[model samples]
Target: MMNATEEFDPAVRSILDAAARRPVHERRVSVDGASLSGALAAADADGRVPLIAEVKPTSPTTAGTRTEDPVDLARAMVDGGAAALSVLTEPEHFGGSVENLERIRAAVDVPVLRKDFLLEPGHLDAVKADAALVIARFVDDVGEMVTAARERGFEPLVEVHSGAELETALDAGATLVGVNNRDLASLDVDLSTFERVAPGAPADVALVAESGIATPADARRMREAGADGLLVGSAIMAGEPREATEELVYA
Candidate 1:
């Protein structure tokens, strides 16, 4: 049986070539100061785990939702307590699109992270076109992706599932790390995995908790465990995206 990571084809491209045609002047718009460095500093200063709110309809793992409107949800996230926004740009698996990302970016002032199956330079370029930081999935070659991200002036957020992948992310020069708790395959989260991997992360790196967080207790655990930020979606969308976003991030 193929793991979720192995299922994606080597021949498939992560981004579209048409990205260059988007209005050049419109590529990068203004964003908040909670950037790569800023998010880390703010998370440290506020003593509250900064939030990375996600925008998506459904996933292969969890395929149930309503109103897949990116702009509305993105705005709600900002109106909530989200410090940043993450937009899924993968159309094949996640039903996401560049238009969604652009729409959300145009409507919100927070920093955005282009969450995708980024495996090619085109993907990096596409995220750069929207001026959103790129999340280099653990399955991708982190170093190559990081190099690609920097070449386009986008921050590379290295995501990892296991401790072994953690080293790969650091070697890739990813100053921002997102530890996705959900396996996507097993569709479960082992919060302790963070403890195992967090120790390997250099002090300079900004550690973020991804997936499986529900309440203030969940947020408190991550904050106490030294996670610089938290990236959540399902839980936030469970209630009013705006209401949940506020409670999750600020709680």
Candidate 2:
């Protein structure tokens, strides 16, 4: 059996290596009241989980979410009512890339969130390419990096896999909390995982669901479970029509 760390996903790595070569400079971008989290909130407020069109491969847990063309699939996601886009740049676990991030950014106008094990300024310095949202999975080193991202006028979409981590994310100044259902350690999808943890989320903190969403019904279940939005990837990547966005968004 492969150790948890051994199942490194290559497609996720290519993009990060590419982003590492970008010029280092603070972006002058500024978002109006509308933000990645805001969009997700707006969509979620409508009683459905607006999918963050994901362009990733099978992960440490998701063993079979592969696509022929991530760029092409990402393009389709925007057309599908994806309030925002979640590009997994961590190849080791998620098989995502920074190249895919750039491609997805160019391919769409909606906010592009760079999903990675963003732990430090060093990591931020790596993906300075073109991402509107930087996903930080709760860390003590986040305050300064959050400042860095916000100074560049980007909203940080922080991810927390559990209630404890959620507190950590909040303490790190994350207004946007993405509750990932798939345990990275186990990689198994427990559909009901977010329910108990969600009520603990601050009312002001926008709650978004991540991982294990395979159908419209799944989206609905999460929405009813108190999630403000869904960070979907594999389901959409599994191949659906552009209009299928309606299914996921309205589910």
Candidate 3:
């Protein structure tokens, strides 16, 4: 049996149930949010892989919760040449909060991706973010999530771990598809995961490699394997944010 934390359905259900209690009207997103897709395109336009540095406070893999201010972290990433930012909003497992997202959005000019166990359309209404992550492993209706994110002015970065999920993402009309190298169930990192699945991705859609990307070599490998961009968290957060971001962005 899969661990409860790793399973997608139960987690998503919990998140949605909690979100339903909040009023959408009070949480409407801003109209002038940054464009995530545009930022990624510009980074890769010069034939270099763009970096989407993540602002993650903690994770199952980390030793402890992050204490650095999110605003400071966001600024460092942008200063280091990161094309965009990914802010974790999952409060329990990741130690992330919506307030972190709000603060980071205010601190950085780059596009921000709200990374969470998101499901409800109202979730988008609750945040003033540029892009949202819709994990393919969890969502029963990928298209619905895509439509909701797009309607709310958020470009959805649909995440896929396998070929089937990639097809689902493509069918859902997702322009930006992220291939997560970490297995949701085991939380294991497989660098080959992206390379294995990226070849099957449609050429037109933007391909982003997420997780387990640390060194410039890792970034170079992902880029060589067809990833136009990278969404990196742990490594960047563990070191000098700006230096890590610049290293990966140019790698």
Candidate 4:
């Protein structure tokens, strides 16, 4: 577990503390057996950027709560042409649960990614998800977590925010990477973050731009900046999910 006294942002520290306190338990859920990389490849083949819409009810930064069922929200995103879905499973900071991941996985044919502050190999086994997120900054041994996720049949989506973190993810042999525009330490968003860090990645590695995306223009900018996909959450979840998703997908 991350030390609370470390230089982590207060919000991030709270989330990590909550994650550390979560009881490790086995979840009875089925995976969709979909490949996040494969979905992005398919979207590329079709000449369209893949959109990995997220199923987030609430966040540490966002206020209020979403009352809709995760499955229904996921279905709406798919209906609006989302290539895959990311379900937040961290309960405290992000109103998420493994049950929601399972329900969404069962409800959608596209790939489902488990988005959480995973700390150890044991955390990977607790949920049934097609893909898993391994934040490079959050784990002590990101390589081990990446290997564990692959061992459990999950396509790991390694997330990074800076050039150093990007190198750490690459050194860990992560093929799928997400460049987050939001700085977890300060909770500041700068869309240009992806533009600065993405060019450093190899061409073969699949890159997904995460956070700070709102409109079609934002999506287009990221796509042009070498993003293979976009992972959007708050923007889509704030309103009519289907319509909000369509605007980004068709854009």
Candidate 5:
């Protein structure tokens, strides 16, 4: 088991503490329980790797990435052919809020994922997004967390940074595996991280490459590395949303 004080980052601790304060039932946003897995799988049906566009306002590394309205940004992604959407709901570190997710969810029809350091089962109940992000390294029992997320009617995109973590996620029955190239410890992004780990992933799982994907070339490399989808934020948020997203989606 992870020592909460030692293993959990300050941002994670803050988020969890805030979650602990709110009643799960009160925080819950009602929505139709959509299948994020089906949306991800279907994106690659036409032979093009799907783009999971992120509505990130800020981050620990790059702050203030988005200046426009959240709803406008989401609509632009949809116009750009994004198969799904990822909304950063980690308020402190990411400058994100459930309000952003709630607004984006109402603006778009595609499945939306609430991206955050999900520590408690009540965290799943906190948002109405179709899916939720669960980092494997943070939780002691991966299987239980995965089961809990599913029980809340949310598809869990289990994220791992290395080969062992990938195996742990798969063994825990995670069908949606996200390989985050950015190392949480060093906060350094090595694009090769995904490439090195992709081959080890099972063919049956929906493999998603997360972080450091900037251009169409980067997207194509992840696709060639066997990624079924790309969870991109900064690059798409930097320029014209529709054009940048369209470029990556087609790449």
Candidate 6:
């Protein structure tokens, strides 16, 4: 049988390896007043499933580079009715940077999420976004990371791919959870992954569906499957961001 590290997708393993080499450093920035969970709640109250559009330049799965300015792309998404913005800051594999998140957060009034394979509390301290993604699959102690994020005044969005990880996240006091449809082990996407896992999630916590969503139909499908928010990356980044975002938001 393969060990945990061995089971990781090659791309996921590469990202973790790169993150491990970074120095533990602090780059403190003021937290924006916008709240990710609050945005989702507000959308829910308005009878809308919030769209968390992502500002991703490129990913391991992307076909080519996206040269658009991060701030411009973010503003377009917000103008299209995106409730929040997710800024990828992984740097190596994702072609993202903390500078981009900072710029986008400054450019838009909407909440900004720092999307990275965070492994330590110090990583949270280095960012300045409104929320941080603490992936359960990558961290040894999901609870510890969640607590650390809250201590730093960041809304922690615990991401899990399976039912067991979902339970672990809940046990760790996670109020905001993201169910990623893409499996990190194989990098395969299946939209039903959210439907299968979302039923078990408590109603009080905000649930976000991530990846594998492209059109209005897909957005509606996830909403019907119990998603409070949708986190879309490649689909929005592939073409006209504003129109793409509007399609999902209005869906």
Best by TM-score: 6
lDDT per residue for candidate 2 within 1-251, as digits (tens), equals 11224342454344344444545444343433237877776666665466777777766445675756777777777777788877877765567777777676776777777777654455564443333344343334556766766765567777666777777667778787788787644456687778867888878988888888878888889988987778877666666736666678766
Candidate 1 residue pairs in clash (backbone atoms < 3 Å): none
- The digit string of per-residue lDDT tens for model 4 on 1-251 reads 23345686788888988887876656533444579989988977876569999999999788899988888999999998899999999888788999999888987889999999988878887878999999988888989998888877899999999999999999999999999999988899999999999999998899999999999999999999999999999999998999999999888
Query: Model 6: clashing residue pairs?
Result: none
lDDT string, candidate 5, 80-152, tens digits: 9899999998776677888999899988999999998776666677667888898887777888888887776
Best by lDDT: 4
Worst 10 residues of 6 by lDDT: 1-10
Q: What's the residue-level lDDT of 64 in candidate 1?
A: 77
Provide C-alpha RMSD values for all models, in order: 5.2, 5.3, 3.4, 2.0, 2.5, 2.0
TM-score for each prediction? 0.80, 0.77, 0.89, 0.94, 0.89, 0.95
> Which portions of model 2 miss their true places by more than 4 Å?
1-34, 44-48, 63-67, 92-95, 128-140, 241-244
Clashing pairs in 5: none
Output the lDDT of residue 85, model 3. Answer: 94
Prediction 5 TM-score vs. true: 0.89
Clashes of each: 0, 8, 0, 0, 0, 0
Question: What lDDT would each prediction earn against the true structure?
Answer: 0.68, 0.67, 0.83, 0.89, 0.83, 0.88
Cα lDDT tens digits for candidate 6, 150-217: 87778999998899989999999999999999998899999999999998888898899999999889
Model 1, 231: alpha-carbon shift in Å? Answer: 0.4
**Which of the predicted structures, 4 or 5, would earn the higher TM-score when compared with the native?**
4
Instruction: Flag regions of model 6 displaced more than 4 Å.
Output: 1-4, 26-33
Model 6 TM-score (2 dp): 0.95
Predicted structure 4: lDDT = 0.89
- Candidate 3, run of 10 with poorest lDDT: 1-10
